[model samples]
Target: MESTTADWVSETRFGKWFLSTETWYREVLSVALREMREIAGPSMPPIRRLLDVGCGQGRSFELLAERFRPREIVAVDIDPLMVRIARDTAGRCAVPVTVMQGSVKKLDLADGSVDAIVCHQLIHHCSQQAQVLSELFRVLAPGGMLLLGESCEEFIDTWSVRWFFRHPPGVQHSADEYVRMVRDAGFGVAPRDIRTSTPWWSLWEFGILRRYGLVRSPLPVTELLLLARKS
Candidate 1:
């Protein structure tokens, strides 16, 4: 339960529990990975080692293994509680899994240590977003891919989400800004490599009213998905 000195916000209790649900795996994690795979197309290099930054509950382990078929997975979460649960999840995977509790702002990884990085739905929780991105760029091998996914400011500012989840307030970004941030961090992200989605789950009222066909706001881009490669 102890927090790190880094400018990171640990997930709320509801947020943490939701991460273990089938809904998260199916709707969020799997979808993002699949989209990034499509975005990468033939450009994605052979991935031998992958680093899963902000790997909550290790939910992405099996999917990362099955999709990328990496030789090893190194997963880290800032929260110690999530790390313990993720360690259990890691053991269930077919691939070699290493779970650690650490902040992404200052990763323990050596420079150019990983062939790929899966950093999904993590940046908004970080106030030190640029520093975190810098570390991601640092540990990734040249030509390695970064599968980055995030909820844009439009989605993160929704009342339902604001009530249930925790995030660094001032650092929330729009889809374009998120794209620019990654580009500024030294990753090579082209326009074709970026994807914007407004999944039903990201709808206002957490899609409850939308599911009932009661209300509709001007649908803005709520999610940003991209495949950035180290140059």
Candidate 2:
């Protein structure tokens, strides 16, 4: 089946190469996995059903399964190849994950069916980001949490990423822009719920600054993770 969208990581040779490797699979995704458990902390409801959007290769399967221990995990990805890999890998996990090919703009699940959403590093790739945000709100059960992780254009336009990755034009946004978009979608967000981060890898090509001790303690933050709740 032809995809309704373009510029996905699965479409390009480099994208496939990067995603199929251990470096990008675990190490790259681990930065956001650290926030997953925190998003599913004691404050939130006992997560029963989970959805991992953009769950390529099911790299986050073990982490989400281990942390939330949800009864079921529904993994969704637009790429058919990724969906296949995810389905194949889902069995390795103790938690049951139903892998499906679907776009974030239009999820196939029922309204308010999921207890939590692990939307890591996926939104910037989407052109219809507002529709995707609204869809997240629609699928999440009341009081459900969304662990939204994305890097800003500053990070995306970097030499390392610009060369290897191809994102949808006019889709990238700053941390505050993403926060506002999430808030505008009717999800409740607080100062504490939102988080801004600067991953070392985001500035990997700019290591000369760090090496020269020119980079300050807090390097330029290029990533944003907002934990929004369906109110």
Candidate 3:
């Protein structure tokens, strides 16, 4: 089906519901954030000038602020409504964050300006995933990091979940394909893990893709947690 940007953003029940409630936002997204931090390591410099691509309602930014204490946080989304809601939600948080209404395929940021770029559950929504990855690579600094959390290719096997995501914007990739994409974008793979964290019977994948090569593993991973650094 042809999915417009509006249809993808406005029709997302989870995003709308997340913007409306604090509890659901905290409960559902916190696990991913915690795991990201654990993999990112505590000794890393406090993330400054961070960019969250496709940040719906800025929930992840809210969680990241409490743990990492970034100096500047920017959240971008293609939908104006999502950006508006994200700005409002960020306003309620302890730290200041900027929300922009823009597409990940074309971000409004200077080259090598951001220290970290995060695209959580957002890559799947892009029809031009490679273009988006290129843009992400372009805006990140040499030592910057890229964190991606996405649905696994295995998710399509389930009939119920498949129906919910049976749209053009919903694209799932296998672990090997994702790794190749990250490397092709000029980043090396780092430490990552793919495991089921949700209580639901559904399968999901989460990973941190970095800009540099720090750690590598041949272990089979369903949902990737990659950390790639720019070379």
TM-score of each: 0.94, 0.90, 0.79
**Ten contiguous residues minimizing lDDT sum, candidate 2:** 1-10
Once superposed on the true structure, which residue ranges of model 2 sit more than 4 Å away at CA? 1-11, 204-208, 214-218
Better structure of 1 and 2 per lDDT? 1
Candidate 2, pairs of clashing residues:
none
Model 2 score (lDDT): 0.82
* For model 3, the run of ten residues with the poorest summed lDDT: 203-212
Query: For model 3, what is the C-alpha lDDT against the true structure?
Result: 0.68
TM-score-based ranking, best first?
A: 1, 2, 3
lDDT of 3 by residue, 177-210 (tens): 7777878988877645333332332322222321
Instruction: Output candidate 1 Cα RMSD.
Output: 1.7
Q: lDDT of each model, Cα atoms only?
A: 0.89, 0.82, 0.68
Off by over 4 Å in 3: 1-15, 18-27, 169-171, 191-222
Better by TM-score, candidate 2 or 1: 1
User: Which tens-of-lDDT digit does each residue in 105-198 have in candidate 1?
Assistant: 8889899999999999999989988888999999999989899999999989988899999887888999999988898999999888888989
Candidate 1: 10-residue stretch with minimal lDDT: 1-10
Model 1 stretches with alpha carbons more than 4 Å out:
2-6, 206-216
